[model samples]
Target: MKNIYELVTMFHDVHPFVPSLSQFAECVVAYIGVFVIKSVFKHLVCLECLESLYSYLTDIRNYSLIARKSNDGLLFPAKDVI
Candidate 1:
């Protein structure tokens, strides 16, 4: 019983520091986890955006190919449809 009391007292003496350190560790871990998730999501979204952009550009190129040159000296590609 005496040993248990001393152990409890010792733990009580360090109570403030224990919780503070635990909270700090948790925040650090959570920040890192959030950063990792954000990076992965950004990468995934960028890939999809790139594919859409390529498709749009290809469509414009096809339009330019079919458009006839006007009587004026300079005939520019048709305006972007989308």
Candidate 2:
């Protein structure tokens, strides 16, 4: 999970404006959702796993907000203004 998050973060940092990044993130979340659903049906998922997945999703959302803000220059003070 940490690795996946890190990879996504790196991708976002490199290509923040790419539309495919959003699609990639959505696909990852969807894949996780399917895994969770299958695990639940098979009685393989535990409470801790669910909590961890929730935490991951929250982190992704927060990171996305940070990325957006950075793109808008809100995360860093302006160095040059005309």
Which ranges in model 2 have alpha carbons more than 4 Å from their true place?
Answer: 1-21, 44-82
List lDDT for all candidates, in order.
0.39, 0.42
RMSD of each: 22.3, 16.5
Superposed Cα deviation of residue 4, candidate 2 (Å): 35
Which candidate number has the best lDDT?
Answer: 2
**Residue-by-residue lDDT tens digits, candidate 1, 10-82:** 8888847434445445434433433444444556666654343222222333333222232332222212212
Off by over 4 Å in 1: 1-21, 45-82
Report the lDDT tens digits of candidate 2 across residue range 1-82: 4798898888778844645457556544444454454455466456654444322232344234334434433221111110
Lowest summed lDDT window (length 10), candidate 2: 73-82
TM-score of each: 0.26, 0.26
Q: How accurate locally is residue 54 in candidate 1, as Cα lDDT from 0 to 100?
A: 22
